[model samples]
Target: MNEALQLLKKYWNHDNFRGLQAEIIDSVVSQKDTFAQLPTGGGKSICYQIPALLQDGITLVISPLVSLIKDQVENLQKKEIKAIGLTGGISSDEVSNLLDNCLYGNYKLLYLSPERLQSDWILERLKNLPIHLIAVDEAHCISQWGNDFRPAYLKIANLKTHFPKVPILALTASATPRVKKDILEILKIENAVVFEKSFDRDNIAYMVFEVEDKLFRMVQILRKNPEPSIVYVRNRKSCIEISRQLQQSGISATYYHGGLSSNEKNKNMTLWTSEKVQVIVATNAFGMGIDKGNVKTVIHIQLPDSMESYYQEAGRCGRNGQKAFAVLLNSASDYIQAESQFLAVLPDKEFLTKVYKKLNSYFQIGYGEGIDESFTFNVNEFCAQYQFPTLKTFNAIQFLDRQGIVTLSHEFSQKIIVQFLISSKEVIRYMSLNPQQEETIVTILRNYPGIYEIPAHLNLVLISKKANSTQEAVLQILEQLQKKEIISYRANGNDSTIIFNEVREDERTINRVSKFLLIQNDLKTKQLESVLKYVSTKNECKSRLILNYFGEQKKENCGICSYCITLKSKATPAIAVSKQIISALEDTSLDSRSLEKITGQPSDQVIFALQELLEYKVIEILSNNQYRLRK
Candidate 1:
């Protein structure tokens, strides 16, 4: 324990461990199988890291997210601790070399995907390493009941079969009792020391609002609680659009989603994390292992499919414990949209079987011949070629990927390379003719050397910034240049590559996954129903509903939530609130965002008052969506 504390003080510059970190570390160092259910920002890494340093051999960490593995490995490396990640997209040769590094590099930690562990070569090589502990991050994924269930995670049990002496430490930030039991059974971990931090975050005022204009409501919420915040949207397009709207409304904001290139994601995340931007509108992909402590708000513009994911994404805020808000914005139409999106994408057995056959045919993989074959899989192209519904097809492929039938490697194609077909002199001549593209051409030429001789990989964000152009314009210019045969360009943006882990079995393939597919479909339906029940139930406290969903029943109302505030505000009559609003706006017009502050009433009350006043022709809405007394 002394040595562990010393490592903590020396490396992390912390004199002591936080919360249950000390106890979890003690259990791990004593070689006990442990399970930790810490909250999102509860320092889960410290529990295994300190013990890994205390032990004699390397710790093999099976994590579900590549971003998470990269982050932890990089952070540890920054502290001069030897850590390496065997994340996806590496060649077999590279994998062997990385495993060799673990053998001889004195590396204390090796992080990898459970899918990688399913490989015979990787499994065999791992058997030789003196693994001290097996740490499973996102351990909740092992549970069929948990959100984000990855079928590959079940393979982690194989490690136990090989390294029987290794102490297994499973860690997850979110899990119900069912998920906990499921995870324990899947890991083959019995009599393990289980530690769970309470899921109740008293500091976070869980707020739910159903409004006709979600954007208007969101702007109001942000204005009311102006601090470092995140706004989660359902899709990539929303990430861009909402952030743009916020920016146009005079807020410093950015966007992030899976569709963005790595450079863009990193740059945007850095901007928001460093307080250069006050708000980040993002897709659900935005918050994995993201622990920015001072985030004052997390607003979801669209309802997530389940309470589990909503809880996780919303939980990203309020980590600083300083009165943060987790706000969910919804509407009557949003519920209909949510149902269509969630239920439509669910892959049933028949749908799964159809997709299975189509995928194999698309790849032209002969029966029992594509066991190890790999192919470039663009979801859009695949859907277009087969005339499958885009969302349903995507969900089907993902289901297969999770079933260990194929690996849909995202962020596997960030490399954008270009080479000039024409000579430098001809390129210069063409650039002279096309003055509009000259700066971008010059930027690419200057940044990437030997582009005339060979293909050189480049970053789109870097090129755009240097060229003083948008990425869209840059790509357009590149495409134009390609048409003229002045240069050959290849840009793969968030495209996925599929590697078949199983041979084509067609009916047999569907048969194997059918039972689980039905079960999973049922699970998703229930989850969506739970989410629907949550948002539509206007009478219940939002905090209590969410807590109860996670099996944390809180009888007391969180007085700051939308329900509690609304319940309390009903005591004041609508006419009385309207009078206050008129008085507050007597001297000047005000927008909805500011009316709540000036009227000294909750947002719901203020909005209701404004609606009534507008109906009576007592107040008028301006072109800018502000309210003023009628002439």
Candidate 2:
């Protein structure tokens, strides 16, 4: 234990561990099937990484997010610890080399996405490696009820059969009691040591404000707290608008969404992580698997679909144990709009069938022709080509993925530009001749290490930014050096994998499949509604409510939620007014426009207040946008 602690301090620059990290580490070292329910920023990675180093063989980490695998593997490598990742964006040769390293090298960790488990070759390769432990990140994904549920994760249980002696560690930030049970059953982890930390962050100030004009409210928030922050919205278009607003306000800001190319996403992420950009306006897809520790705030301009997602995204703030803020700016229309959007995206059978056929056709596979081939997909292109709307199309694809009809890989690809362009021999000779620029040349060589591998067709934006040079300047140098036969550079692009099942089985045998997908979509919608409930609830400690939802019992009021704070501020007559409003509605069916006249409150305030009441079930919604009291 002391030896591990020393390594922790020596490599991670931490003298003391946070939360239940040390305890979790002990469980892993003891070779127990451990379950860790740590909140975001609780240092979950170290729990397994440390024990993996102490064990005699490599620790196999199964993760759903490829971005997370890249992050963990890179962080480990930076600490001088050997680790490798088998994810998308690599060639078969690379996978072969990585597997060889895992077998022959003293690598402590081998990170792989759960989707890779379907590959028989991968399974066969793993059987020969000396794997000591299996760590499943985002363990909640194994459960059908989880917010980020993935069918591929369910197959991970078969690992026990392959490596019976290896202990398994399941970890997640959020999971309901049902999800917890499902995870244990699906992973077949018996006699597991479970350790969960309190889901409270004293340093994070949570606030929600009522806004009529969302853009105006966002401007105010950015003007007031202009530190490193994230602004989350529902659509890709909003990502652009919000970012433009921030830039107009003189804040260094950028936007990220699925619509952007992988190079753009990586550049934006890099700027945000390096503090080069003060704000990032992005969709929910931007934050998962991100590990930036200095983010001072996270603002939700639009609501997320599930409490699990909101909690995870909001938890990104204050990771460094410093004071931070998370705010939700919402209006009456925002709620209605979000709900309607959710309903609109529910796929019909026709739509699903069309997409299934289109997917097979998209990959040039006829009926059963596309059984196992994987290809990169662009949602916008697919939608445009097939005339499918974005939201419904995305929903349909997600349904297919959940039903094991396909596998989707989400990854960001970037372009690399060379700092000093020169040929191998000429560059060596130039360095040999010009000792003055030798250090600069060497740094450039080390940074653009892959220049020799794929010289042409590379994205030079990132490398240009890293080199502190203009893209043209970097290119000019590369061209000159290449002309001198010292080096070479080029441009390239690649797509993310979204693989489809090729076999067109008999419809009768697979009737359960489409029904199962429909059920999954409905449940996902419900999860999003639950998320809305958490954000809008004013009757319980927000943190405690979140913890309880994640299977944690014995948790008390956080004393920091809006409910507790409002109690301290004294319950105002607003409650009484709300009660009277509910009563009046029960007596007579009325719209907000009519209710406002009787309530004598302004339209926007009355509408906002009424929506809150409706969400709390204080008033039951009736026909034609009318409302009635529950009693």
Candidate 3:
């Protein structure tokens, strides 16, 4: 224990470990697989990060969010620790170099998205690294029954066979009893040490306001609070519109969504974290892995997909132990919108097959032509070309994934650069000889660096800033260079990776898969219903309800809940006034009317006489040129 504390103090600036951090670390040190169900703000990262630093070899953290992996790697690097991240958008050569560094270099941590586990190269390379521990972030995603399951997560259980000696640490902010069991069984952890933290925040005042004008209500809350707050909306358009509205009202605010450039997201997040922006209005994409400690409020503008997601997002507030608020403003249509989103993603076999065929045609691929052939795709253009609904087409793609026909992954826009191999004057002379293609080649050669090295990664923001141009213009110039064969540029694109298994369709096989997909959809709908229940619950303490949902039992109700306030109000009644007190006010301005109103006793004779006189002087007169109480 003392040694663990020393590591905690040495690595991080903390004197002691909070909640189950010590126990979680001890379990890893003792070579026991562990499962931890810590609530938000419970320091789950420290549980794995600290042990990874103290362990014998590298710790591989499998996370679902690629953006989160990138952030974590950067943070670890800032701490003077060697960390490598394996995610899409990096070149294949960069991945090989990174994996080589992890295997041979002194890297303590390696973060990878679950999708990377499917790569054949990754599996081959894993056998060479001296792995000490496996940390699964958001482990609940491994369970098909869980709210946020991914098929890639299911493949993680095979790690036990690859590295039998290393201990595993599974972490999640929210998971039900069933999901908990599923995670444990799927991971094949035997008698894993369990650490569950209570989900209660007495400092947060949970209020549900039934409102029609959600945007106005949100603005009112921000105006009154005047603290760091987050407004969660349902869609990307809402994030943009609400953020604009808040700015128009003179509040320091910004919007965040998955659609924005990575640089834009980083800039907005920095502004909010540095307190330059008082509020951030965003979709669900905004809050994961954000570790700001001074957020005073989390206001939900629409119904979230699940209670787990809502609690995690809402828990971002009041981390500094100050008073904060979590308010949910809802209307009738929000429930319908949420329900429709769930249903739309679950398609029948016929619809799925048709969508798949249409997608192939849209991409201009036939039979076996597209196998292992990668190309940039424009979703809007593809949809227009195929004459299909974008939303429905997207949902159909997800369903096809469940059928195991193809694997889908989101892509990000990244820049590329090359180092100068020849003199700039020589290149210009060469361009003069071949003007048609040489001009484009010279343009790119002068623009980017490290490109001479194969599959080099470049910072698009820095490049654009240096070029004094928009990203669109930079991409157009790159495209022209690619066309001239002076440079080969992979256009930065937004499309899911489609790996076709190309299974021959059988009606029975399709039916079985479609039925399974529908069942999963029904389960998702039930999860959303659970979120609605949390919002509508009025008879229980909000804190107690949340705690109990996460499998914690509290002995008493939090005295600060709306339910407790209602009970207190019911037990106490308005006081009566005493007549003797009314008679004593000899110099008061009241004439006959006050004298008659005060002298008559209603109930509890002594109380009524005193109350009537006080009410008459302070309350009644104040309303119609009333008397003021001097402090």
TM-score of each: 0.83, 0.75, 0.74
For candidate 1, write residues 1-631 as lDDT tens digits: 8998899999989898888999999888888999999877788988888888988889999987766788889899998999999865677888899899999989999999788977888999999998999999999888888877887898899888998888999999888888999988988997899998888888898888756568877887788877899999878788888999998877889998876766678889999989999999988777777878899999988889888788888888888778889988876578789879999778788888888888889988888878767777788888888889999988888888777788776653556789999888888888889999999999998998788888998888899998889877898898998898888889765467787877798999889777778778888999999999998787888888877877787879988888888776545788888888888888999887787777677667777778789899999988787889999
For every model in order, what is the number of clashing pairs? 0, 19, 22
Question: Which parts of model 2 have CA positions greater than 4 angstroms off?
Answer: 78-80, 88-100, 250-252, 258-267, 270-277, 292-294, 348-350, 371-376, 402-405, 410-497, 500-512, 552-559, 570-631
Measured over all alpha carbons after superposition, the RMSD of each candidate to the real structure, in angstroms, is 5.8, 8.8, 11.4
lDDT of 3 by residue, 28-67 (tens): 8888999998878888888888888787689989987665
Q: Top lDDT: which candidate number?
A: 1
Error of 1 at 476 (Å): 12
What TM-score does candidate 3 reach? 0.74
Candidate lDDT values, in order: 0.85, 0.75, 0.72
lDDT at 251, model 2: 79
Q: Give the TM-score of candidate 1.
A: 0.83
For model 3, what is the alpha-carbon lDDT of residue 421? Answer: 47
> In model 1, which regions exceed 4 Å deviation?
87-94, 412-494, 567-570, 574-631
